[model samples]
Target: MIPIYFCHRELLGLLFKSQIVLTDPSEPPLKTVHKFMQKQLTSNVSKPLSSDVIIKSNTGIFFVETTEKLEPSPLAVCAVESASQTYPDRTIYFFMKGLTKNMTITKSSFYKAIPLLSSMENVNILPLDLEEVVQDTPLYPWYQKVNPAKEQYWKHVSSDGFRLAVIWKYGGIYMDTDIVSLKPVQEINFLAVQDYQIVNSAILGFQKHHQFLWDCMEDFVKNYRGGIWGHQGPGLVTRMIERHCGMTVFKGTEDIICRDFSILNTQRFYPVPYQTWERYFQVWNPKDSFNNSYALHLWNFMNKNNKRVIIGSNSVVENLFMKRCPRTYELIIKHASRK
Candidate 1:
């Protein structure tokens, strides 16, 4: 049974007392009430972090979660664990916009996974304050004025903006939570190709204050479209690539070098296209070696039904988790056995 922390009357009273500005009259009242409650809950549950805690530039692996869920999905846990294990020398920072300072085993649904991720010396699970992260970047002004609740694709738009801002502030690899790291990234500055013409922003690597990233941020605000999907993410990156690197199609598996950064081939990150996302969930005969890949993007977005990773499924995804993120794999097996 779900827990009810507040009655409808109290909720109404709280909503009336709060200072949340609903810019769009068409916006649902329920969403505004929910946001107010979330803000109140976050404030009550966690204290702010000290200013001394800092993320170093050029030597970090980043993963951002824009949702308010305290418990990360199993795939997200695996993504962080695999990156932590692969890059032991470099720091792995998992920034959750909803994360609070006091979220611990007793309070979070990710009790088992949280402790496991925290045990890694190189892993740092931190809070992601959108305003603070985009402070000095081009997105700052837009972020301040934009009413996220009014945007149709606010989640994706915010994530797209946050990645560029964070990467610009402190250089490193910015990978989506669905990407499982298999090897250390060799390129100093790079973007992964999603298809022949599109360069995906799911996995990016750059140095601090890279001009390419700055230009991307500028374009993000100039061409902002909350209603259009991918307009701020892959589309923005692809446009920037066309401007900087020219229109180059991927014919072979070789990396294309621009002025300062390189555009990696599709095999390096997205070995399986989104159209074939089920290939990851299905059992393979010989099993894929993924020899040419550095990491596999699971395309979790394509899993619309939210399929469970069965223990004995022996699917490609199961195998990847078993090998790349053994600890998370074990947890999955353990939970399934209990069920």
Candidate 2:
């Protein structure tokens, strides 16, 4: 009786408060008291505070900078699809600057190849209009003035500017369409190193209205040299890091935490160097699983003329497609059969 009273104080209190006086030693049965205590416990803390619970949300954005809206290549399909799969919970957006028509996941060409991408309700396709992105962006006026003589030059320089502007306005992520995501990007603000000496602007993540992004936009205008290759792209990003973080050359590991922002090593994005871009699509060691890499950049520009992802080839790219984007792999296999 003593132990029961100590264990169930509320029950004892209720029994004591009752008007009925228990003169008999066998007044309250232990079993009856246990049942009453159970009822009291259930009554006290049953319902949960439904509204007080907080839900976590994150947004990621990717862009395709092309002039015409052709069917998305398998690699391009893999890039967006893998990103969507890796971060299923996060809001994933794909921006096509050249596309005039808006497309839903159901209507998109890549949807047939990767059904998982279509199921991702969080994924959105948006048109990348310079006028829309540049309006509120700090470097709009500067972007208007730069006019490259050649179309190819414009494609490179304009994309460099657009990436910065859109990211500044939206504040999520800006990944080049060639990047195939392997895992969830954890850092809110990060830049990936292309090599030990250079940082690539191909992948950038930031919170909305990050001041560092604003500074990068400003620097793009001040150091506008569209003719020279990489001057406005990787070179600009490296220069900005040097100015702010005091990093002359980004010598870091898979993850580097700086005072201003975090930096990921070259292996995270560019596991296969530009010089050895073909090796990525070739038969390599099956054991070499790029464990440290979060994503792999196919370096489309470098391999544009030579390297192609064959359907039957047991190459690294094909293997990646099988494991990461299986539906896409099946689609490619069917296409190969038809061919």
Candidate 3:
């Protein structure tokens, strides 16, 4: 379902023995997979744990930072809605339902938790009407509903609704939890990166009145167009937008002026003007004063050279943000560092 991207360095091999096994025959296969993963992840592998399961949980609210700019504002600064729940920590044991115990060194990473990374911010988990949202969005290749005529009416809508939901709930400048923060975010919506590559959602920003953003989301979701448009889906949206005719409205219009992004979905076909796809990684070698930037968007393959990291307790992105905001960073890091 969802991916859980977290830091896991100190407890690498140790997590294996703490894993859970599913043998319930009544549950669906996907259900079993979810349970197995949940236990392995949220099972609190800590030693001699307490009575409950949760360590920490909070829901940040989103409010308007400034009344002037609403179309595209910093989603987080806009305090909307946020809350969380958790139980005490405890340890448990189980048996393998499939393979033998010798299957050690498994690739048990947090794919589902990665997206929740952005949720760390006081994001408003609004009770949005799933049906309404699904209907307002555009049509994309990935929009699929097995029972089209019956239970999945909103399946046709594009990711615009999802994008809008994120902006409205969590703000644009959202950070994927898996991303290790490196520096202090000087300002909100600082356009650090160039206007290309679908404005990496891993670290993005916009104003509150950024209806243009909604428009962009609408265009991407409804128009079924995207060059590097992720979040709603992978590079699927990004791929479809390329099959367009020539001259198509000064491609940079959206990049430089219009924020819809859909107006210029051809980064692979063009240059990103002056944006450097660096800094959004584990190592940055720019000895010179690093300016004209806000935050790094470790979209994928956190390491620049794609180095095979051991996936430790603190991800590269987490370390980065804490380096910037010590108090805020440490609070989250120190708490998450628990067993």
lDDT of 3 by residue, 162-220 (tens): 43434433343433322322233434332222244433333344544355444455555
lDDT of each: 0.75, 0.63, 0.29
Residue pairs that clash (backbone atoms under 3 angstroms), model 2: none
Models sorted by lDDT, best on top: 1, 2, 3
Q: Could you list the CA RMSD of all candidates, in the order they appear?
A: 10.0, 18.4, 15.7
The most accurate candidate by lDDT is: 1
Candidate scoring better on TM-score of 1 and 2: 1
> Where does candidate 1 stray beyond 4 Å?
1-53, 102-104, 107-110
Scored by lDDT, model 1 comes in at 0.75
The TM-score between candidate 2 and the true structure equals 0.75
Clashes of 1: 0
What tens digits encode model 1's per-residue C-alpha lDDT throughout 108-198? 2434655566656677665667787787789889998999789988878888988898788788899999998899889999998998978
TM-score of every candidate: 0.82, 0.75, 0.35
Error of 2 at 50 (Å): 28
